[model samples]
Each structure stands twice: as C-alpha cells, then as structure tokens.
Target chain A: MDKPALAAWLGAEITGMALLSGGAIQQNWALDVLAGGQAQRWVLRTDAAATLAVSRSRAEEFHLLRAAHAAGVTVPEPLRLCTDRSVIGAPFFIMRRVDGLAAAHRVVRSETLAGGRQALVAALGRELARIHSIVPPRADLPFLGEPASDPCRRFVAAMRVLLDAGRLPRPMLEWGLRQLEISAPPPAATVLCHNDFRTGNYMATEAGISGILDWEFAAWGDPHEDIGWLCARCWRFGGPGEVGGVGPRAPFVAAYEAASGRRVDPARVAWWEIAAAIRWAVVAIDQAERHISGAEPSLELALTGHIVPELELDVMRAVMARAA
Target chain B: MSWDGHEAPDTRALLEIARTTLMEAVIPALTGDARFKALMVANAMAIARREDGPAAAAVHAAVRELGDVAALCAAIRAGAHDPGSADHDRIAASLRALAEARCRISAPKALG
Candidate 1:
C-alpha cells in the first residue's frame, strides 16, 4: 500500500519507517508515526505468502496472543488485527511497539550487555516456567493438542516424511532415527511451551527480559522442551560458557528450579537440547527448500542449509555421548 | 585437509561464492518485487553473508576437532590409550577435552 493510503487507514502521519526482518511467514515493520502531533511507534506485522502453509491464520495468532497475554507471559500488547487483504494485499496485525533489543549476536557479544547476561538468562528461565504454568483451555483453544508421550517419535516421523520428500542427508536421517530410539526422554506433565523460546526471539533491556516475541510455534508440550531449547548450543551465538550465549547453564537451571519449585532434571534437559538441534536442522532444510523451489530464492535459506550438517553433528554427538 | 573423505567442497568454500553472488548480483536486483519477495532476498543475503563470513569456518573447525575426539574415543576403546577402565569417565574426559579445544580457536573474525 502507498504511504497516503497507509496513513489514512492508520489515522496517523507516518514519520519514519524501517523494515524489520521478514520470516518465511510474516513481514514486520517498525513504523514511527505522529498522532495529534505526538510521536508514537507501532509494529506492523503482515503475512508473507509462504507463511500461509505452516502458520495459523491472523485471527488464530491474534487469539492465541490474547490468551498467552492473559496467562501472564510478557508479550507485545495486541492492538488491532486486520484480515482485509484489500488494505495491504495480506492479513496483518498491529501491536504496541516494544522497546529494547532483540538481536542475539549483539546482545551476546557486547561488553555492555555481557555483564547482565547471567541475570538475563536467569530471568528468562523464570519467565519460561511461568509460561508453562498456563492451563490449556478444554475447548476454546481448538489448536492446542495433547502432549505426545515420545516427542522423539513424532520428530522421527516428521523427519521420515522430509527424507522421503528427498533433499535431506540419509546419514543424518538414519542417525537421528537411531538416536531417537536410544535416547528418548521420560514423559512429563504436558504444559504450554513457547516452542521457539531462544535468545533471538526475546526482547531485553538493561533491567532484563521485557517480552518474548514470535508465538507462531507455541504449542502444548513437555515444558522442559522449552527449557532445553533455550539452552541449545546453536542459540548461544559465539559466547562460550553460556547456555543461550548469555551465561552459564547452572544459573539458568537453578533460577528455573528456584522459581518453579521443581527439580530440574539434567538428563531430560539434555535430551531436549539434542532434540532442539535436530529440530533446527529440519527447519534449516525447509528454509533451503523455500529458496531451491523458487518460492523465495533467499540467501538466508541457502545459508541455513549449510548449517544442517553442523546441527546434525551436534545431535549425533550429544545423543551418542548420552547413550554411552 | 580432507577429514572424512567427502569430496564436496567444505562449507566455507561454497558459501564464499554464494555470498559474492548474493551481494553483487541478487541484492541489487530486488527492486519492485512484492514486499515478501524482497524481504526473502534480503534475509537470504543476511544469512549468506553470516555463513560466508563467520559461521562456516567456526563450524568447520569445531566439527573437525570433534572428529578428532571421536577418533580418540575409538583409540581408547581399542586400548591404544589408557583413558582409564571406566567408560563413562573416559567419554566425559574426552568431551571436556574437545570443549576446551574448541574454546581456544579464536572467535570467528567476522563475528567480532
């Protein structure tokens, strides 16, 4: 849409605009505007064409966001959701603009931010514990499903589908399947898991975590899945001795244990961490397919493809080590 | 230089060529496409640049070192090295050694 049309629709004069990173499923924008001569900022999130396949509809995402917010997870407040494709050529949602930073690389490496890394990681663990405490609605949330007894089985099944589709490494497939059989974690109480909880998906300031962003992958599952994912090595950027590339694993786990009043099982967390690596590998391949299939020829997807082997190696090494 | 006999060029070599093409060819041609298309190209470029610049070398070095650790484990299993009789402790020591080795490799220049 043109600037004038967007201004008319938003009822504000747009002063500055910056395009945020667009994922496979959504286009995001940072819009600075003036209303009644007072400056305001809002995030404009719109669906990308490819996102229609794997994503919940805008209405569903909005509803889920509302539910999650009500359950007390820190998130950007939803303002308005517009499903009219005529306005912007896609469904879009507007939300209150959040301040602070989201770039993981910057946060992990910067000396200024490095000092607070431990505190931030601990805070993140507590926040995740809180999110997992939310009870799934019996019927109102139609999309939420029961937690599987063996998430590894589900992962293996999904990987088989992808492998059968071709373009995936056979060795990695075999290795993952073997690992799944040998190193599966014991089942625990199912709870709401922010499936994509990681460094890049969160907003942070000097004080600590402000909000967790990106809810497209949220689901009902083993809560420890989120914990392990948060500590996955891939998400650690380049920071050594840090779980999420922020701080040591002990503090992160300790903070969660203290907050939730439950013993954090190291073995279970390790299992999920390995699973997290495998999941990333699968997602990386999907991103590569997006480029190779001509749906969206992105260097990002191609680069993402390169990481699959590394991820596969991590998964193999972790699982093998655990088995031994 | 070849660790596991895979004939394909290492990730570093492959990504350098791809990154060059992306920056010199693809990014400049992204005008007038749908917003999503443009975004995809841009995101792709970011990933390519990151891989070409830092992640490729870092991951390659890490993997090669891990392979060495695996070889060490094999040696210990064959009784070539006295890593102790306890299998669990042997594996744990090997892993710790690998982690320390990885930490010594200078942080990727590009990531800096």
Candidate 2:
C-alpha cells in the first residue's frame, strides 16, 4: 500500500512488490528487497478490506505463526510483524517465501510435485501432528481465547446460529446439525488445529512439504478435526486417495498416531468429517449470499452456492451412517 | 424472437445451447483463469437449464406438502421426529428427495 513508509519501517530498499493471486481472506504480496546489499524474497500478508468472520486477524495470526513455527510445524518463517497502521494502513506481517504447487488440483495430480503419494501423505500427517502438538493454555496464543469444552457441540451450536441467520432455511444442514448435536463426543484434550487443513493450503516441492501456508483459522480444537478436515471428501479435489486424495486413511492415521503419540480414533474423525461437510456448506452458502444479496457480485461466489447440494449429500451420507 | 408459439425455443433450450457451445467451442480456446470463468459460466447455464420445467417444480411442491424447511428443521431439533418414528422417515425422505432434486440441477454427478 504505502511503499515508502514500509521501506522506512523495514530500513531496507524495496526492489519490487507484486500482489499474489490467492488469499481472498488476506492480501498477500510477493516482495523483494535489498537489505545491506543482500537480496531477499518474502511474502507480506495483510487483511483484506472485507474480512470474513471466522479467520483470525493479522496480529492474531502472527501470534499463531510464531507458536506454530516454534512447535516445528512446517509453516512460513514469520519474520516481522508491523502493527503500526500508518506504516501500511493496516497491520501486516512478512515471512519467507516458499516455492511449490499449492493449487488443490495440481497438488493432487502432479507426479513431480507430490513426489510419492504415500511419502507425501505421511509427511502431511506428520505436519498435522506437529500442528496439533501445540496444546492450549499457552500464554503466547492468548488471542485464541479458551479451548472449546466440547468442540463438536460447540460447532453444532455455532452452525445453527449461522444457518438461521442465512434466512434461506437449509433443512439438510439442520438435519446434519441435529445428528451432530445428539452424537457430540465426550470432552477430550484440545490441541491447536489447523481448521482448514486441506490440499490447497500447504505447499510442497517433490515429496517434501515446504510449508503449511494458511494459518488464519488456527485455534484450539479437537485434534480429530484437523484429521477429518484433511480426509474430508470435499477437499479431495475429485482425487480418490483418502488423504487429501493422496493416500488411504489407514496410513495417514498411522502416521499421525506414530508422530503425535496420540491414539487416532476413526469414529471421532468420522464425526468431524460430517462437521467438516456442514461447515463447508455453511461457508459456501454465506459466500454465495454475498453475491445473492448484491453485497459482492462475483461469479465465483455465485457458483459457490451450487456446491451446497453436494456437501449436503455428503452430510446426509455421513450423518445417516452415524444414525440410530 | 416473437412468442408466437411457432416452434420457438424455450429458455431452457437456449441455456442448454449456450452451455454446449461454451463447453465444446469457446471453453476449449480459453486457458487458466479465463477458462475457469468460462467453465463456471457453463455450469451456471446448465444449472439454470435443469432448474426449469415441472420436474424441479414438483420437488418444491412435494417438500412443501411435507412442510416448510424451517418447520421441518425445528421439528428435527426438538427431537419430535425421533429416528425410528414414522414422521422421522417421512421427513428424512422428503429432505433427501429435495436434496437429490437440487443435485439434479446443481451437480448431478455428485448424486451417484
């Protein structure tokens, strides 16, 4: 935004900066700088003008990145956080730039990028395990508030509020919530979960994961959620492999279990998978509502609503399987 | 383009033609983001075309007869239509049927 002021703040000569294509939630700029005659490449992340409700703020995300990076989670090395609005008009953070394919389709299909399917899947499982290694009640991540006492029921309650607010009644989502509410799991230990742990969110070169890119949705939740999210059908990009369309569920869970030293429960993961479907359905409707209500007229958002039926179908199948 | 009932193509037919042209001719020439946008346009056209006619309308009527979505959802939440109850099966069936109808228009491949 304000290049001169940013340069002064960093005390580095800004050679070039260009906005990256992704990050609808946040605006990412690929930046190059010459600091003390040393060339450096980095990415700057800042909040978009119209922010979504669920994601953490730039300041909060910085804390999350710090914690995640500290815990050995494969994330971009969070370098500096500029909180002064005057420097760039909004809070922004800079991190090391990672090069790899993060596109969902490409990441799922590319032989070169994904490396070996089992190896990559195992690596991702280990990455998720590292993310979950960061337990709650940490002083650094105070912005996350408190861990959900019962993440499943908490999600169901929140989804009900959102579904009602949608105005256009979604019976399918309601049904799924009803099923989820009754089947709420007993409270267990909470861990820091990457709520959006799916294919497109992480970058990898060959078989080695460069970094986990999206951190805005990181919060204290059930570890199974991140697991289910990774295994969620909607996130598969039509690839048949169970783990982000990369491999089967058994090895992924085995890897997570071996890495995290926590028992991986298939039933709990199944329940959260339903929650994931409902969660995406709610978000898809909300995104589409932005277009439908004329708040944001974009073809992408408009077509997002059409995806609800498929997600709803997913919910029904999963919920029914969990039924009496 | 008169509505003179003299072999006039319906709106659904027009949308089908547009989507077919987009998929077969126009979209093949597009790449990257432009191609993605064209695919979305084609998908929207297909959805709109399928949403027309009595088959789609009949689903609304059937679901309405079962009850509005809100009431049905409320009933579900209250546990009035418990799992094995007659009303549970009926309501679930109706909702499933409605969802399937929506899939027919929005994402038929997703149904199977």
The segments of candidate 2 whose C-alpha lies over 4 angstroms from its true place after superposition are B1-7
Clashing pairs in 2: none
lDDT of 1 by residue, A1-324 (tens): 566867778888999877776667778888899988999888888876677354577766776677767767788888788887777778778777887788888778754452376777778878777777775554656776665666656666666566556553334334445455455665667777778898888888776677788888777777778878988887888776456787878788888778777677887787778778877877777888888888787665665665665565566567557656
Error of 2 at A46 (Å): 1.2
Cα lDDT tens digits for candidate 1, B4-106: 9876776756656766676677767666445436555545544544545544565466445445544443343334432234553544444443333332232
* Tens digits of per-residue lDDT for model 2, B34-93: 998898898888888888966588667767766666777788888777687777776776
Which of the CAPRI classes, incorrect, acceptable, medium or high, describes model 1? incorrect
Model 1 stretches with alpha carbons more than 4 Å out: A2-15, A34-38, A111-115, A138-140, B1-112
Which prediction has the highest DockQ against the true structure?
A: 2
Model 2, residue A258: distance off in Å is 0.9
Candidate-wise lDDT, in order? 0.68, 0.85
Error of 2 at B92 (Å): 2.1
TM-score of each: 0.72, 0.95
